[model samples]
Target: MEQDLIVVGSGNAALCAAIAASEKGARVLVIEKAPEDMAGGNTKYTAGAMRFAYDGGEDLQDLLLDPKDERLPRTDFGAYTAQKFRDDLLYFNDGRPLSPEQDKLVGRSLETMKWLAGHDVKFEPIYARQSFEKDGRLVFWGGLTLAAEDEGVGLFEAERAALLRAGGRIEYGLAAQSLLVEDGRVRGVTARREDGSTVDLRAQGVILGCGGFESSRELRHDFMGEEWEAARVRGTPHNTGDGLLMALELGAARHGLYSGAHATPMDRHMKEYGNLDIPHGDRKNYRKICYFLGVMVNAEGKRFVDEGKDFRNYTYAQYGKAVLDQPGQFAWQLFDAKTEDLLYAEYRFHDAHYVQADTIEDLCAKLEGVDASAALDTVRAFNAAVDDDTPFDPTIKDGRQARGLTPPRSNWAQRLDTPPFRAYPVTGGITFTYGGLKVDDAGAVLRPDDSPIPGLFACGEIVGGVFFNGYPGGSGLTSGAVFGRQAGYGAAASLSPAT
Candidate 1:
């Protein structure tokens, strides 16, 4: 195919790039490492929640597929201002200043969402997971309230359909091996087909959006640590650093925290690369993120982190690494019957693993790898410290605390004295690597000397430096859209007569 622009990968970022470039009259071709059914990178494995700044309910209502839904009247879609979004990103920056890429992400977030809506992608309130009904009104917390309809799969299908409608073409089962650079400028890529045939695809410009190296055990052991080698992959196994390696081989500068990643508390026995046989919605059941509703203990039967330090969205990404560092790379989350109704649906899934007992003593005894006696003592200490005067409320950070403990619970601290206590085993599941190729504001790959590489653009996980130690929840997809659009525009502009 004689294409004007080549987009590597077929995830949200790649599709957005292809669609945008096609809109600019560029003939775009997207190459995917996975077959068509397993395409869309880590996006298909997600719940499709997207975090962006909006003024209030009105702004959100404008983006919904059905603005006239009856529930919109009673739902409180609180404002998530641009300042709040910047604050959330800075909170996870590990004391570093926000980068230019992050600035673009924040500035362009809402417009990029609107842009997606303009492209026929639909969105709906994330009521099931992010909101709680209080006083006959649904209140959304954590500053994240919207998601693409039907979650990740829906988002992928919608974007893929839009790309096809825009006259963009996708070639499945073709893994890009290296950039086709001629005279120090990228021309296209050399890819290997699934049937072992090699093909040279030439184009005016190339945008690499494949993904990171979270699936590569060797890269994890080398860049992160030996402990990370044992961490289970939460997304596609095909993201084995192919894009990162290809970029580096061409002198692209490396950026971001290679040792850090977006890890989550997953079922201890989840299939190594995640189960593909199950339905898309069922796959998220493997994640156990309700630890905020209870307490987590390492193998030694002791509290390791302040479970209520913040909302799950702010803490869940880094907590998984904490779980990986625990003995046996596992921990158990214990909750009483009090919070049973408040737990996410993932906990109630049929395949969800847990041990339930009528008493704390019995529950501790059932913990597979923990010390029973010490666990009982720990539970008793935690129970004795909780302040019973404050009323429990799940809709907000009510400041109900467990005081005078070694690692005190700062909020939502309820004693596990109720009958039928339950414990769920969990371990760290890596979602994506934090390190990737450094790109400029236009999403053009930059050399170490900070010069843009001609005909080479990048977005998605392949373009890094937007995050450091951790990131706020739902920012990944938004980042991809924002930068992918930028890269597509930049690539198309490069093909102008003046260039």
Candidate 2:
């Protein structure tokens, strides 16, 4: 079929590009590597939390699926300004200044959400995981409050519906192999169908939104390190750097930190890739991110990171790599009964792995692959250091520190003396790779000289230089949507009128 634009992916980014291109009077086609049932890429594996700058609850109220939900009046959806968003991104940039891609992400975030809302993608407050009830009201911290209703699956479904409504077509089970370039321009793409048939589809423009190389063990070991080979994949196994490689083959400049990734603390025994057979909401249950409510210890029975250094949103991504770097490539999060009710629902999931004991000594003894005596000593030290004078509060950084330790707990530190104590075993789960093809602000793939590759645009994880050493929680989806929209517009503009 003749098309004005070809989008090589089916995730939020790809769909957004397709929808946007179609809106601009371009006939768009999307090619997916996964079957229709599992086609949303890593997007379906997320909790669908999207971090964007917003004025206040009013902005969020307008995008809510049910704006009149009873909680709107009582929920404190605090404002997250563009400056705050930029600050958060900079915090993870390893001391580098914000890149142009990051500036676009921050500046376009809220408008992109509004644009997505116009596409019928509904959102709701992420109350269950991001909020804490206090003073008879739900207060959301961490500058992230909204999420796609029903999480990733819901976000994908909504975007798919919007794309279809815009007259965009998606061919599932067709993996894009290489770009069809001619005269220094990308004309289309060659793809392989599930039936082993090959098709050379021609288009005026091609957009690669296909994802990163996190699922490729070889790529992980080559780019990150040998230890990353043992890291579990938290998303789709299909994102083996096909899009990035295809672009690189065309001399598209590689950009961003190839050695960096968005990793998280996940179930140590979770399947190599995410479990797609389960319900959408249950898929994210493999994550164990409530470490601020407790403490984490490596195999040597010693605390590795300052668990209370910051909110989980800021630290969880980097901590996963730290976990992978641990002696056994795993760690356990220990929580007492006092903070039991504060833990995320993932901790109580049926498949969640944990060990419980009535006494601290017994809990330490139950930790497999850890020195029991040392673990016991570590716990005793932690409990003794906790400043019991400071009142415990989850709504904000309460500054209840555990001081005078080798690596002190900076905030939210509490004694783990309450029994029975529970420990959840966790390991590093790679979400997406940080390295990808370079793209200009318009989302056009760039050559090493910083010139746009004619007729080729890129977005999503395929577009690099946005993230580096660590990632602020919930920004991946927003980045995909933001750049996807840009690439769509850019692709449409690049299309020849005759097409």
Candidate 3:
């Protein structure tokens, strides 16, 4: 039997593609590698934050479910214009201008969010992670303010509900083996069933959205350097580069930084892979944020990257590589009593590796893998460099920088002299690789010669070149949705005359 579209992988991207194609009167069939419980790929383990350009509070109010509430006056959501979005994307790309592919993603981001909202995917302010309540009003810092109603799980369930409502079918536990190409055109795919049987699923178009090589230690050691082998998989174990390999086999040109990925500081003792047995709320707890509120020291008891060089959303992705390069491939984040109240929700997790002491000297003694004497000295020197004249503020970039310190803290520098120090052990948690298939603005997979591969389309993490060294937090899902919608429309329209 044949279908109009075969969507491989049941993540946000694949689901968006399936629903879009089905809405166009195309029969869409989805292939999911994992069982029903673990179906959403990396989308299942995210905070579901959606980053898009908004004019201001009034612009955001148009997209929210409850905009007229009395609390609107107290809250301030600064504008994130299209120019700002383009600038942020270019900043990570080393100040180069946005490519046509990137321009398409950024330009259509707001539209994608609106489209998802029309499908019943609710949006709300990210209070827990992106905002702070000051003087009885919530102020959303950073450019990110909106997220899916209930976070990652909620976004996935909403997409699934929308897909089913549009007459789409998802088959779980059928891992895609390879693409079926005939006469230099993709026709379908060969997938392996859970019972060890092979089936040829034919369709007019095929969309590969399975994701990156973060879960494969061998690939990590080969492409992203050797230290990444010890890094924990922050998402699904099934994303072992299957879709990437399948496209590469068909002459798809690879693009972007092969040695870089979106890695973040996570709990050192979290499970080897994302645990499906735990609740979605517990899944996000593995991340260790609020590092900008304190200082991070290597096992050698020396400061590395400037913890406050920028907002955590801008720096956290690349900082993981610095931690992986530390001695024993780990680091410790130390905080004083002053900033303790401002710590993120993840700091309160029961399983997080942490120690508390009444003084800096006692806290150094409790840091197991870190050198005691060196850590104490590091803290003292860092405290001495803080510019005391600049008042501390967590809501904005107060220029309270540390002067004359090696690897200086650029902002939010407060003396760690207040009693009762706390520390958390941390290692790199890789989310996805930056290297993947090159695609056009419409998500059509392209060849080395810049020609689109007929009948082949891609979206989500599988479509590369959008992100380079550093990633602005919450933009991944936005890119996935924007490109996923295009890929679905492109796939169905490519065969419209014949259908």
In candidate 2, the residue pairs with backbone N, CA or C atoms under 3 Å apart (3 or more residues apart, or in different chains) clash, namely none
TM-score of each: 0.98, 0.99, 0.97
lDDT of 2 by residue, 1-499 (tens): 5788999999999999998899999999999989999899999999999999987887886688988888878888889999999999999998999998899999999999999999999998888888999999999999988899889999999999999999999999999999998888899999999999999999888999999999999999898899999999999999999989888888889999999999999999899999999998899999999999998999999999999888899999999999999998999999999998888889999999999999999998999899989999999999899998999888888899998998889899989988999999999999998889889867899999998889889999988889998878999999999999999998898877686
Instruction: Predict model 3's lDDT versus the native.
Output: 0.87
Clashes of 2: 0
TM-score of 2: 0.99
- What digit string (tens of lDDT, one per residue) describes model 1 on residues 211-235? 8999999999999999998898988
Task: Give lDDT for model 2.
Answer: 0.91
- Return the number of clashes found in candidate 3: 0
Q: After superposition, how far is residue 14 of candidate 1 from its true place, in Å?
A: 0.8
Give candidate 2 regions above 4 Å deviation: none
**In candidate 1, which residue ranges exceed 4 Å CA deviation?**
496-499
